[model samples]
Target: MPTDADDRVYYVISDLHVGGDEQLGEVEALPELLAFLERLERTDENAELIINGDAFGLWEITSVEGTDKFDYLTDTYPRLFEQLRTTGDDVTITLLPGNHDHELAAYDEYVDRFAAYNVTLVQDDSFTRRVGDRVVYFEHGHQQDPNNRIEDWGNPDASPLGYYYNTLVTSRAGQLSDRGRYNWLKDVQAVTPTERMPVWLLSKYFYREMNPLLRYALVPFLLLFNVSAVLAVLAGLSLADIWSTPVEEGTAFLGQFGAAGTALWFLLAVNVAIAGLLLLVGIPLYFLRRDVRKTIDRFGVFETTLTVDAEEPYEKAARERFAADEETAIYCYGHTHRPALSEVDGGVLVNSGTWLKRLHRRDGAIGVLPPVFYPSYQLCAVRIAAEADSVAVEFEEIRKPSPSTEELTLTERLLTLGRKPDPELPDRAEIPNGRSATPPEPAE
Candidate 1:
C-alpha cells in the first residue's frame, strides 16, 4: 500500500517522555529524534510536525521535580522549536496537551512564551485538521480513562479535593507505577491497590446511586481512581508474573506488607484487601450498571466521545468564521495506549498510544509477561491525508536512544532517595485559555 504520495506527507513525533524515568538508555534517542527532524526538514519541506500530547511533564514536575531527570529534555525543547522554525520557517507545528502536561488548559502562558518558536497550542483536547479533502480530529485521549472522564473537571458538584486527587495524584501516580523502571515494590508504593479500589467502587456507586444528578459530579471523580486502579492492577499483575523472580514462600507473604511495617502495615493491608474486593465487585458492576450502559452507548467500551452544540449561536458564529462545518462532528478518543484508526457512521475515532515505553524484562525461569516498561511506550504521530476522493492517514514512531545498564543503575539509586528534579517553566506571562492564540495551520 505504499505510495509516493503517501511518502510526501509525514507526521513527526509527539508525547516524548523526555524527563521521566522511562528515558533509561534512550537518552541517545533524543539526538536521533532531532536528526529525524532534521531529515524531515531537508527531505520533506511541506511536512508537518505535530506533538500530540505530553510534550512536557509539567504535572510530574509539580508533584516530583526532577530537573536532572528533565535536564536533557528542557535543554532540547527550545532548541527543537528553533530548529523547526529555521528548517522551513513556514512548517506547521501543532502541540496538544496530555494529562502529563495539561498546561494547555492555560494557553496564554504557552503562546506568549513559545510563540516566537511558532508553536500552536490547542485549547481543548479535541481539534480538527484538513489534509487534502479529509478532516482529521486530534485529542490527547485521557477522557476515556474513566478515572479522568474530562467532563468532571468543570462540574459544579465535584469537590476540589476529589478533582485534585483524580487529576493530579491518582492519575500521575498510576502512570508512574505502571511505567516506572524500578522493582515491583516501588511500583506498589507509588500506587496501592487500596487507593485504586475505593475510587473504582465509589465511582460505580456514585454513578448508579445519583444517576443524572451525579453524572457530572461523582461519576467522573470516582471513575478516575477506578480506571487508574484497573490499569495499575493490570500492570502489577503483568510485572509480578513476568519480570519478577519468585520469592521464597515466606518472603512472598512478607513482601506483600510493602516497605513500611508498624501500624501502617495493617492499614495498608486492609486498604489493599478493600481494593481487591472492589475490583472483584467492580468488574461485574461494570458489566451490570445501567449508567455504564449509557456510557457505553455514548462512548464505546474503550472510547470517549464529546458532542458539542454546533447549533448554539456562539458555536455557529465561531464555526462560520473559522470555516468549520455546522454539523455536530463526533470526536472519539481512547486511552488504551494503542493507536487506532477507524471511521464510524458519523465521525472518527482515534487512540493515542502512551508516551511511556512498554519495557519488559525476563528473569530466567521467573515467567513471561508484558514488561512494565513496554505496555504503551512509543512516540507516535498521525497524519491525516485528505484528498478529494477519500481521506487516508498513517502513524509513525520517532525512535530515540535507550538507557544503558549504567544509566539504569544511576536512576535506581536516585529514585531510592525520592529526589528527582523539576522541569523549568518559561518566565513569560501565562496564556489566558492555556492555548495558543493562533489556530493550527491546516495539515498539508
Candidate 2:
C-alpha cells in the first residue's frame, strides 16, 4: 500500500560523522541539533527527515568490525539514538549511505537495527520525491567522484580509496584534534589533495597547539622579514659612505646629513642584522616546504578532483541528469560539505553541506604565510516545499553560538585592521532566484 504526503514539508541534512569510538563528541552543535528536531515535532508532525547520506562515520571505526558496529554506535550515541526514536514517533527518519558510511549498505542487519527505532534505512543508491510540479532527485553524490565511487558496494571487505585515506590520515588527525580545545581538525577529511594536508595541519598547530604569545609574535615578524631585504640593501650603501660623498657644492649636505645619517644607519644596520637572521631561517624553511610537498606526493593519493572555476563536477552532473529527464527540476545531494544553490536546466540544484565544523584557509587576506584555517560551520538543513508552479529549496542554518564563532583568525584580524569593522550578523542571505547559465565546458 502507498500513501501520499504532498503537504508534508521535507527536511534533509547530512554528514554528522559520528565516529566509531568516543568520537560522538564531535557533534559540536548537540543542543541546536536537538532543538531542530524538537521544532520538527511541534511544526510539521509527520514531516520526513531524510539524512541524505554519511549519517555515521563507519570508516572512522578503528577497532570494531562486522555487526559489532551496531552496538558500538548505539552505545556511544545513546542520547542521539533515543532522540531519533522519540522523534520517529512524529517524523519518519531515513538514513542513506555516503562514501564515508558505505557499510550501512553492506549489511542487512543495520536495516533491522534501525527498524527497531522506526527509522527507515534507504539502501538504494538514490532516492526521489515529488515536489509540486517537479521531481527532486537525491543521492549521496560520491558516485560522480571517482575516488569515493565504490564499484563493489555493499561488501564489508570492499573499500574505496577514500575509505583508506580517512583511516590513515583523518583518523590520525581526529585523534590529535580531540586533544585541542576545539575538535574541528577531526573534520579535515573533507579537504583534498595529499599536499594540502601538511599546510592544513600546520594551521591547526598554529591555532590550537601553539603558545598564544608565540603565535601573536609571529605575525609582525613575518611582515618585517618581507621588507628586510630592501632595508639591508639601503644600509649596505649607507655604510659604504655613498650618502656622504662630501658635496663639492656645499658642506650643508654633509653637516645636516651627518646627524640624520648616523641615526638612520643605526636603524638600517639593525634591519640588516634581522634580515640576515631571517635569510638564515628562510633559506632552510623554503627548502623544507619543497621537501614536504615532494614527500606527500610520494606518499600518493588515490584521486584529486581537478575542479575548474565555475563548473564543479557535481553541478555538471546535476544539470545533465536534470536535462535527461525534464520531470526532475531539483537535484539535491550531500558529500561536498559546501552549501551551494545554483540555477541549471531551468531549475535549481542544492547541496546540504555538512554539520561538522569546516576549516578553510582564507589565503585571499594574507599573501600565503602558513595559510590560516578559518573555522566555520555550514551547519544547515535544506527545506523543500511546494511552490506556485515549481518547488523551492531553502537553506536554513542551525546555529549554536560559541566564542569560536565570532573569534577571527590571526590573519583575518591583521588583514582587516584598517577597514571598517565587519558588521557581523546572523547567517541570513537573500538568495537570488537565478544565475548565469553553467559556463560552457572548457575547450578541449
lDDT tens digits by residue: candidate 2, 277-344:
76668889999999998888898642364321223777788878877877777778878776666666
Candidate 1 per-residue lDDT, tens place, 1-444, comes to 112333245363454544433322133345655676676566544566667666665444433332332334446465565675665454566677666555445445555445556666675766665444334455555543444345644222333222355445533554554342332211211122123434433322332233555344643344344444444464456557853332234236666667653355354444445566777797788878977789777876533222221123222333332345423222323233444433333333334444444332211121111111111224555554433343444455555434333333331232223322221111111111211121222222
What lDDT, from 0 to 1, does candidate 1 have? 0.43
The window of 10 residues in a row where model 1 has the poorest summed lDDT is 423-432
Q: List runs of model 2 lying over 4 Å from the truth.
A: 23-25, 178-187, 190-195, 211-220, 230-311, 364-369, 402-444
Residue 160 displacement in candidate 2 (angstroms): 1.7
- Give the lowest summed-lDDT range of ten residues in model 2: 422-431
- TM-score, cand. 1 vs. native: 0.46
For lDDT, the strongest prediction is 2
> What RMSD, rounded to one decimal, does every model reach?
17.5, 6.8
